[model samples]
Target: MASRSFAEEDFSCPVCCDIFINPVLLSCSHSFCSSCIQRVWRNKTLKECPVCRTTSSNDHPPVNLALRNLCESFQQERKPKSGPGVCSVHNETIKLFCLDDQQPVCVVCRDSRKHTNHRFCPVDEAVADNKEILKASLERLQEELRRSVNREQKLCKTAGDIKVHAQDTETQIKDEFKELRQFLDDEEAARITALREEEEKRSQRMKEKIEETSKQISSLTITIRDIEEQMKTEDVSFLQNVKATLQRFVFVSVLLNSNHHS
Candidate 1:
């Protein structure tokens, strides 16, 4: 494969613009770094190919094993050889470290006037010490990352809880409003019923008053007719019944005054 040359871009991921790391293939025949594709799809509703924008059928796309092997081979071929370094000053192999100068040096440089009084240590020891320091730094960074991750998780949980609380509060508000609406409806009905009952009572009283007035008017009319008939009688007959007629007239006058006052 190395004999058949290929461009670096051919093995690169479109999303990361770097050599594919754990490449995954989509059904659309496009590939991307697994982490890059997952990052792109994190906030999206549908999984899709990054280059083609084609929807993916599977959530966990298959790893491109052939492409991965090729990339690994390519990386190995491109890696620089780590042979013993040559000293710029003595042109000898660098095998020691100058503690005072803080630089790698050849054995010949250790005896030179420039490093005569400088402390020295083996390159291996220096390397081991530096690795230990780096390891400590890496541990601190990992601890901080863990704390950050835990905080983020807690925040996400709180957000979900807040959403649930809001839904519950909204439901409670709706239920309270429904109860208030029912109460108002009942109050309005009661008021209307009371008003209707009062109106009926007043109407019944008015009807009774009208009927009594009609009967009084009818009685007055009959009395007036009787008096007129008596007036039409012969002179001798009218004179003989004058006293009874006067008494009836006085009774009618008293009835009219009573009716007027009432």
Candidate 2:
């Protein structure tokens, strides 16, 4: 009954009615499968709901992850009966373990053409490789994590120094502005001073602007340089060593790609 209720839920996709895998709700509040929605959205970004022809943008698709997970879990709980292969290539009761790959083999596919000269390793071998690959991946991840933490720490220190320098610069600017103000005020009060009041005010304000801008530039310069240095300092030798270590036990594809993934 619960499954039925979920299946009949409003806005359910027609293709996958048991809660949408990726729901595409239309302007009419009706929903459809994301693949179906994509087919429609391709025709028009401003697509109307199929049910009501109401307008809606195809930019967003709603996904009910919890419902999807529940549905999947329920489906998984129901075990299927194990049966023999229906295909001659994979005889009934025999699974197609890749002969070359040392996977499960069906007798029908034992044809010398497919299994010729191929050594079949048991499923256990594949599992062992998988565990080893996973372990290596974890170690690489841990190393990356350590490097990232170190990077953050270095960046923080650099930022702190920039901030301190900026504050000191601000203090100097304030001092200069104060002196300029006093000089301008004195000039205005002086009877015979040649300086115009407006001109002095303009000069003072412009100097303040210049000082503030300079401080900002200094901070930005420091931040940018620090980032460049960090990015440039990657240890090529270390990367080569890691790649070499991984190549000994796995396929070249896995070993080569590990560098990219790492």
> By TM-score, who's the top model here?
1
Model 1, 162-192: lDDT tens digits are: 5566556556655655667755767655655
The 0-to-1 C-alpha lDDT of every candidate, in the order given, reads 0.66, 0.47
After TM-score superposition, the amount by which residue 178's alpha carbon in candidate 2 deviates from its true location, in angstroms, is 2.6
lDDT per residue as tens, model 2, 1-262: 2344453344345543433555555556576767766766686756666667777754665655555555454344322332222322222344334534434454444553446666554334543454455456445544544554555456556555555665565566556556676566564345223223433555565455445434433443443343333323323222213333344324433533453364
Q: Give the TM-score of candidate 1.
A: 0.34
Q: What range of 10 consecutive residues in model 2 has the weakest lDDT sum?
A: 233-242
The C-alpha TM-scores of every prediction are: 0.34, 0.33
lDDT of 1 at 40: 88
**C-alpha displacement of 89 in model 2, angstroms?**
7.4
